[model samples]
Target: LATGDMGIANTTPAACLVAAFTGRPPEEVTGRGTGIDDATFERKVRVVREGLSLHRPDPSDPLGVLAAVGGLEHAALAGVILAGAAERVPVVLDGVNADAAALVAVALAPAARGYVVAGHRSVEPGAGAALSHLGLRPLLDLGMRLGEGTGALLAVPTVRAAAAVLRDMATFEEAGIER
Candidate 1:
């Protein structure tokens, strides 16, 4: 399974989710979405702080937190992650939105953390926080912040190539080569 998100201004709620889960400060998790200017970036950070302050979401109760601060897309992506975990499938998570949702999924099912693979690291600070909390290192980091699964898509080939190398590569003895 692979996860991606496409929505405007979704990073605001993502930062909120990261703060709620990781206990990070709003400004620490927040970032400029779509290249906003100074004032807009400042306001975005403020909005994230206000939302977290108002909601006071409990990370232990992921459902309650989602209800309080999650966007519809966040909830939807969380569902995908949960479903993938249920089936013991590895999920490739993309960007900040997917990272936030992955946090929600792990909170709901701690074992689910093992099933998530970070496709790539986003420039978004929240993405780093979420990946760190999940103990996941992204497979790629091309300074990507574009959602819509572009990063994940780019990572799929890498995953496949790695798998192929593990499965098909021959050892020195198998290749009849001297040690």
Candidate 2:
């Protein structure tokens, strides 16, 4: 399942959700999103930390965590992941926002984790931490910080290549060549 959208302050919510779910320091999960200045960056971090504290996410209750700290895009992405899992389709997570949504999805339905693919490493600080926590290695890392599915869109060719190799490339036996 592929999805994309735009929203302001998405990174803040993402960082907060990630820190809440992973128990990481908000500073560790936060970054200079969209060229935010030092002061603004600090404020973003503080907001995330405070939001986490205010929400007090219960790891066992995914909905509570989402409602308390999640952005609208994150909630939608979580639904997309859930739908993909129900249909046995893979979801390619884009940036920090999508990764945050995937985290919520996995929390709500542990089995959905099997249906998710980390498309790329986003420049967002929480992106790397979230992917690491989920044991996912993205196919690319171009230092992209955009959150509009740009990274995931760029990864489609590679995904297609992998599928081609798996489905069409000749095996040694079929080629009748020496190993």
Candidate 3:
């Protein structure tokens, strides 16, 4: 519901949660998305703080956490992650929002973390903490914050390359190398 609440706005609950999880006020962690005026930024920060304080969902219970403050998009992304994990497919996480959803997925199924791939690093401070918690080192840092799965889309080539490597690379014995 948080994303719905901030429709067309850059201020997302994932962004706010990032700040909260990192123990920083929004002023410290919030990026100037689209260059809001100072007054608007302050208000945005206040809104984030209020949202977090109001819910205060425990990280251990992802369902409760989602119902407490997350939006439909977050939940949907989490379902996607879970489905990928179930199918044993690699799932690329895009940005802070994806990271937040992945956090929920991990809480739901600890093994899901093994199937996740961080597509890129987000400028959002909360993203780093979530990445660290998930033990995922992002594969890229293009300085892009487009969210909307753009990062994951860009990571496709890397994923295909990894698969090709595993499938086509010859073993030292097969190549007749004397190690």
Candidate 4:
């Protein structure tokens, strides 16, 4: 499964990319990343707006969007998700950062969504919104905010256990037992 690594200011690029793709206003896509103060938050919004204006991403070209506004981790994770889809493997997304990256990946390759799993809900302000845009319901809601693949890692075991139950557990009839 694909997971994403996030850092400070990463959300800025994500918001920019989302705005570029969805035709949303920058403020609609922006959020108080990492709980920045009012002044810094304003600066963050300005930066995202400037970046979007400078890039003017071409919706027909996903790579241009990545090169224009995407972070290294976002680009890398997008690649990982794309590769996993090519190999028919499922990619479990972690949080907003991964959610953003997956949005780009899916925009590039619509088939990729079939290989993705939303792992959990993050406390990041834009996370829930992004997940909703993607039409994904997270498997958990522990109010996690960390984004180093932590949320996805936490959900992996539960996914595996469920798969095992479906594949390995025997029915009562097979076990010669009463229901």
Candidate 5:
């Protein structure tokens, strides 16, 4: 399973969600999406802060927080992540939107964190914040911000290689190697 998104200004809600979950200030989590101008960036940060202030979503209640601040794409992505976790499938996360949804999914099921894989380091600050909160180290850091699962797709090969190694590599004991 992999999560990605194609939404306009989706990072605004993601920034709000990250702030609500991590208790970080909005400015710290907000980023300029699609290379917005300086003024637009400032407004984006303000919007995130206002949304957080208005909602005051509780981190412990993931559903409530998501409902209050999450966008439709975020909700859908979170559901995908939850389903993947329940099925014991690895869910590769793309950028900020996917990362925010993963936070919601993990909050609902703490064990779900194990199923999540950070595909890349998004240029969005919220993506980094959410990854840190989930204790996930991204497999790639290409400074990528394009969603649509581009980053996750790029990381799939690496993930598959790692799985192959784990499945086929012989242990030192099996190889009879001394120390």
Candidate 6:
């Protein structure tokens, strides 16, 4: 969800949102998105902190939070999550940014979590906060931070296979086999 930065650090919506919700200096929550140099990273942190000053997010109102600090991708991701819940499909979350977006989605629709899954554990510390807030446990812990849904995609087959087994596999009593 929140992967490579698409625009200038100081100008990006995602940076603003992260800062507002975190209330931490960028150095505390920011990372080299795609391995930027020290100067760029510093600027990224400064920009995030500055953005936070511009917009303060209220966690109780997730959509307001999204509107205040979230980018197009964040909004779109939230939309997908809502759609999944409406259609009764499970959505597998990817990494850090995804976790933040998930928080927004969860705030919007608490029941939406019933159709959600944590795909992996992200290297980002904030990610753990999001998961803990949502009461989700990741199925895998490759210590990854790959966004663009790659991490979630990686877990899809595993999730589907597990679903298949639960739906189709026979129990000992049904199979008439020994316990």
By TM-score, highest first, what's the ranking?
5, 2, 1, 4, 3, 6
**How does candidate 4 score on lDDT?**
0.82
Prediction 5 TM-score vs. true:
0.96
Q: Which is superior by TM-score, 4 or 5?
A: 5
In the range 1-179, model 1's lDDT, one tens digit per residue, is: 77888878999999999999999999899988799999999999999999988889999899999889889999999999989889988789999999999999999999888888999999999999999989999999999779779989988888789879999999999999997
lDDT of 6 at 16: 53
Strongest candidate by lDDT: 5
Of 4 and 5, which scores higher on lDDT? 5
Give each model a TM-score. Answer: 0.92, 0.93, 0.85, 0.86, 0.96, 0.79
TM-score computed on alpha carbons, candidate 2: 0.93
Considering only N, C-alpha and C atoms within 3 Å, which residue pairs clash in candidate 6? none
Question: Residue 95 lDDT in model 2?
Answer: 89
Return the lDDT, model 1, position 84: 88
Compared with the true structure, what per-residue lDDT tens digits does model 6 show for residues 58-140? 76777888887777677777777788888998888876666677767778888988988888877665566567767999887
Q: Where in model 5 is the C-alpha error above 4 Å?
A: none
If the candidates were sorted by their lDDT against the true structure, best first, what order would they fall in? 5, 1, 2, 4, 3, 6
Give one digit per residue, the lDDT tens place, for model 5 in 1-179: 87789978899999999999998899899999889999999999998888888888999999999999999999999999989999998999999999999999999999899999999889999999999999999999998789789999999989889989999999999999999
For model 3, state the Cα shift of residue 23 in Å: 5.9
Q: Please give, for residues 1-179, the per-residue lDDT of candidate 3 as tens digits.
A: 11111234543566665554445666665655556789887887787778878877666667887777677777887888899899998888877777878888888899998889998887766567778878899888888766667777788789889989999999999999989
Task: Judge candidate 6 at residue 111 and give its lDDT.
Answer: 91
Colliding residue pairs in candidate 2: none
- Candidate 2, position 87, lDDT: 96
For model 3, the local distance difference test gives 0.73
lDDT of 6 at 4: 23
